[model samples]
Target: MNIKSLLLGSAAALAVVSGAQAADAIVAAEPEPVEYVRVCDAYGTGYFYIPGTETCLKIEGYIRFQVDVGPDESGPSSWDAFTRGQVQFTAKSDTEYGPLTGVIVLQANADNATFQDTILDSAYLDIAGFRAGLFYSWWDDGLSGETDDIGSPVTLHNSIRYQYESGDFYAGISVDELEDSPFYNGETPNNVGVAVGLGGKAGAFSYQVTAGYDTDNEAGAVRAMGTVAVGPGTFGLAAVWASDPGAYYNAAEWAIAAEYAIQATDKLKITPGAQWYGNYGVVNGATDADFGSDDAWKVGLTVDYQITDNFYAKATVNYLDGDDIDDVTTGYFRLQRAF
Candidate 1:
């Protein structure tokens, strides 16, 4: 063969080999597919299914800015401002027993440039009709307005409860660890309490009855409340009776409250409420001399305005009077946004 022919043949072979290598490199392997989060409408809004899991998760909460005027039993502050934020997490799944759910809430408050400690507002689990956890006491049933204090103290404690529900009828019973409860009076031998509640609604009328028994003091309190729709508003009436006064009802032997919530407009609500306390000033089985007054009453008005879908503003003014105590007035304004 001639020298030129030999060189041409060698170059052609080299080109063929390089072309094959380039073709192999251009052919890439297929990639794995990706999974995305899916929305879960089974429970409610703002819920989504966890990737690759049947469990559904939801997160919700609110932020509140409040301004208060007047003096409380705590101290004499002409005005005070505070901001509070809360977040809640919920997880739900279906099980053989029924729908199982868990919830956790965290809260923080800041007042006058001082930040308070964070709080676990609520943590609980529910399956079927059984629940257990740290939560508010069952005695918390009352009207919407803050002035309607049905003599039930607001506090949280560890508890286990079983509840039954059918349509608008429901009943529940709970046992609480009352050692750290706000109702615990000094040196109580017993540190447990039991509570039961029954509630139902028929048409535009609804009623609820709740009772709590303190094992240590061998005393209890009973509260009954009813509401009915009348004209452009709803009227509510509630009464409470306690055997140990402040230990259970956070009031005297007996107390009564009435409120009327008027839907003045689509975005505005006005509620006027009144409460009367009889045989006032008994706390933890002991009667204080300052509570010498046998009767005390309070009248208050609340106005709530919905600024937007998730924003609201509320204002409340209250007047308090008693047989021996000086007349006092208090009020607060609050703005809140929720998700």
Candidate 2:
């Protein structure tokens, strides 16, 4: 071949090679695929599947502002304002036995001037109707309004429980550690309590009976409650009897409460309730002289208004009267937003 032809051939080959190299450099690699969060409807609404796991997670919370006007420790009566925020995390997974769930709730409160301490309100696990960990006492379950107090003091406890539910019938039993319970008086004994509850619904009527025994005091209390639908509202009745006063159950010997929740509108509810206490204020086997009252009664009205899907307001006014004590009136207003 001629030298000029050879040189032209070499240049053409070099240009071809360089062009191929440039084309290869300009070509980009494919991007990695993204994993998006998937909605989990297996449990309920507002739940999403946890990434890279079969578990489902749900986060919910509420912010509340409250104004209270009532008796205080140092003052006869005072008005106080407080704000509270709460967050709850829930995780659930299906298992061979049943659905396993874990919940954690954190709460913080602040007054108008000072910030209160944060608290872990609840931490618990449930599997196959079996539950354990720190939770509210089952005895505190009652009607929707605050007026349906059957004298059972509401508190939290570390407990283990098993519940069986079928259709409209349910039963549960629990063993609680009551060492740090507020119901204890001076010296506590066994510091343990047992609780059992049974309930069923038939047609428009539902009834529940619960009993709690304090091993330390060798005393127990029994509570029976029932509700029936009437027209556009519901009527509820509850009765409680305790062997010992203020011993993990009723604060008095016996108490009865009645409440009627009236649906004023689609977004408004009004509940009027009344409670009667026999041998009121008797605690730790104290006589009437200690409390200066043998009987007491309370009447209250609660109003709830739902402003939106996740916003609501509540107001409650209560009047308490005793045989030998001054009549007192208390009330509170609360605004809340939930998510």
Per residue, candidate 1 scores C-alpha lDDT tens digits across 1-339 of 699999999999999999888784655778878878999998988899998899999999999999998876236658888899999999999999998999999999988565576899999999999999988866866887878777456457788999999999999999887765443344443378889989999999999999998776566889999999999999999998877643456566778999999999999999999999887765434322122337999999999999999999999999988886788899999999999
Candidate 1 lDDT at 7 equals: 100
State the lDDT of candidate 2 residue by residue for 116-141, as single tens digits. 87999999999999999989876868
Task: Please give the CA lDDT of all the candidate structures.
Answer: 0.84, 0.84
Any residue pairs clashing in model 1, and if so which?
none
- TM-score, per-candidate, Cα-based: 0.90, 0.88
Question: Model 1 Cα displacement at 103 (Å)?
Answer: 0.6
Residue 220 displacement (Å), model 2: 0.6
Q: How much does candidate 1 score in TM-score?
A: 0.90
